[model samples]
Target: MSPRLVRIGLGLWFCAIVLFLLFPLVFLIPLSFNESEILSFPPTTWSLRWYRVLFLDTSWSNALWLSVKIGVLVTILSLFIGTASALAIVRHRLPGAGLLYGLSIAPLIVPSIVIALGMFMLFARLQWLESLTTLVFAHTVVAVPYVIVVVSAALRNLDETIERAARVLGADPWRTFLLVTLPALRPAILAGAMFAFFASFDDLVITLFVSGAMETLPLRIWNDLNLRLDPTVAAASCVMVAMSMIGLGIAEFARSAGLRRLRMENTDG
Candidate 1:
């Protein structure tokens, strides 16, 4: 086949894969709007009753709040820990830096179920299970690697001479980072925080293993599935999907802004 034809075929394949992936979400949107008690696709009637349940129902609302709180805490902790790790690996060239990087991202490679099981045992011994703090900590472990990867990539792309200039100007390491490095890292930091938040918010296996009594949004959805089929679950899923899309949009905007600033600086230089 000609190269142009091959390219056309690849483009069509990519579009087909994207549509296949999005099919479930497309199916769920209509189900979420269905007024009927049953979760039937192509609903006979449409209403916002399920959406009302998402807001008015105490269980769903409380679960949503808990998930948000955990997500925020996880994001903050992950950014702090991950950024420092990334800096150490990228800037300091610490001995065993490769090993550290491997360890940092190991959670992503290892099966999540294994991590959950291990965490369950550890938290049980620490008597930390069923606590919000425990959930946040567990989520932070999973989230930190994303932050590290993002910040490390951004750091690699940064102009190192600016940092050197700051140091030569008699600025302390801390001040140099605050004035030079941190500003350049803002977009990556924001992106990492969003990813971390979503990771925590969407996690179910870890939450199920560690949480004995605490209910997160995913846990609440699972409970609803077991107890009874409710259209409210669809509404909740839609809300989460919307939240994720909004977070991604904001992250993309921040990334573009950062790129524009970088371009302007390069031009000025």
Candidate 2:
């Protein structure tokens, strides 16, 4: 094909791909605002009824709140475990390092249902069922692998020479790590934390098996959908989508800024 023709084809392909991905979301955003009892294409009389229902219902509010709390906790927990484990795996030479890495990433590869079943049985044995503690623990276990992957990538790009220089200048290993290494890893850590938050917050399968009375948003949404599909659920979904988009926007903004900074640095050098 001629270069001009190839460029035209690629442009059309990219636009088609973008529309395919985004069209559903465009429909959904408007459909969520429908005042009608039923969700349908080209919804009638868009209003805030569903949104009002979401805010007014104590059960929904409480579940959403619980999910948020759990998500934040899981993110923090994942960052701690994942970032630490990533450093251990990537930076240190240890016997059976490959085995350790495999173990660390095992939860990600294992199906959620399988992990849920294992957790359910283990928690039942320990009498930890129905507890937020157990739910958070399980979520953290699953979410941490994301943190490990993100932070490890970030750590790799960070020049190790900074840490070495700090150590040579009479800084102890712990001090050098705290002041130098940790600072360099911040953006990646934030990215990992965001990933962990979303994973735990949006989780349904694992939460369903492990949790009982303490209902998270995903569990409540699942239960609601099972009984009867409601427009309110669509509203809630819109809210979740908005939340995710906010996070996505932040990540993209960070990436853009980082790239610009890198370009500036390269130009200066």
Candidate 3:
């Protein structure tokens, strides 16, 4: 085929894949606005009643708040642990770095249900199920891999000479990291934070096994789905989708700004 034909074929293929992935969302968003309690497609009427219920109902609101709280906690923990792990593996070149890196990302490789079952057994033995702290830590186990991957990639791309220059200028290791390295890593860290939060917020399988009486937003949605096809669940899902998009937008903006700043710095240098 001609090069022009190849390019057109590739573009068409990409468009098809995108449409295939978004086919569900195209239906979901509309169904969320359906006036009827039933989750039928192509709504006969449209209303925001379900959205109102999602906000006004204490159960749904409380579950959302709990999920947000846990997500934030998990994000912070993941950043701390994952960044340290990445620095050790990528920057310091620690002994057994390969093994450590594998261990760090092991959660991603392991099936979530297997992890959930293991956690359930352990937490049950400790009588720690349903604890907020337990949930945060459990979520953190899965969320940290995202941070490690992002920070490790960024660390690899980062100019080591900048850090070396800071050290040569009489800055201590701690000061160099806090001022020079951390600022450079802001974009990757933010992106990782977004991923970590979503990992916790959308987690259901592990939460189901470990949460016990505690209800995060996903658990609440699952419960609703099991009991009835409430339009409220659809509304909650739309809210989550909106939040995910908003988080993605913010992360993309930060990444772009960081890249522009890096370019400007390079130009100045």
Candidate 4:
């Protein structure tokens, strides 16, 4: 086949894949506007009533607030732990770094359900179930891997000479890292924060096992699905999707800007 024909075929394949992935999301938007409370596509009598219900209803609003709180906590914990692990592995090159890296990311390799079950058993035995701090720690276990991956990749690409230059200029290790290394890593850290937050926010299976009486947004959605089909659920889903897209856009913008700044710095050097 000619190169041009191959390019055309690839383009068509990409478009098809995009459509397939977005098919459900495309239908969900209209369903969220259905005035009747029923979740039906090609919504009849379109209205914003469901969105209002999502915000005004105590159950939905409370669940959403809980999820946000947990997501923020998970993001903070993951960033600290994951960044430290990445730095130790990539920069310090500690003994058994490969083994340490594998262990750190082992949660990503393991099935979440298996992890959830183990956590449930352990927490139950310790009588720690339903505790907010325990829930945050559990989410952090899964979310930290994303941070490790992003920060590790960024650290690998970062110029070590820059750090060395900072040190040679009489900067202490802490100052060099805080002033130079951390600034360079802002984009990766932000992207990792986004991933960590969403991982905690969207988790349903693990949360189901440990949350006990606490209803997160995902738990609320699950209950709604089981009890009734309503446009409120669709509206909630749309809101979650919108928030995720916004977070992703911000992360991408930060990454691009950081890259541009690095390029300019390199040129000046």
Q: TM-score winner among the candidates?
A: 4
Q: What is the lDDT of residue 121 in candidate 3?
A: 98
lDDT tens string, model 3, 147-260? Answer: 998889888878899999999999999999999999999998998899899999999999999999999999999999889878888889989989999997887787777778
lDDT of 2 by residue, 75-179 (tens): 889988998898888777667877988888888899999999999999989999998789899999899998887777766666678789999999998899899
* Per-model TM values vs. the true structure: 0.93, 0.91, 0.93, 0.94
lDDT of 3: 0.92
Q: What's the TM for model 3?
A: 0.93
Report, for all candidates in order, the number of backbone clashes.
Answer: 0, 0, 0, 0
Q: What are the per-residue Cα lDDT tens digits for candidate 1 across 111-181? A: 99999999999999999998888999999999999999989988887999999999999989999999999
Clashing pairs in 1: none
**Per lDDT, what order, best first?**
1, 3, 4, 2
lDDT of each: 0.92, 0.84, 0.92, 0.92
Off by over 4 Å in 3: 1-5, 256-269
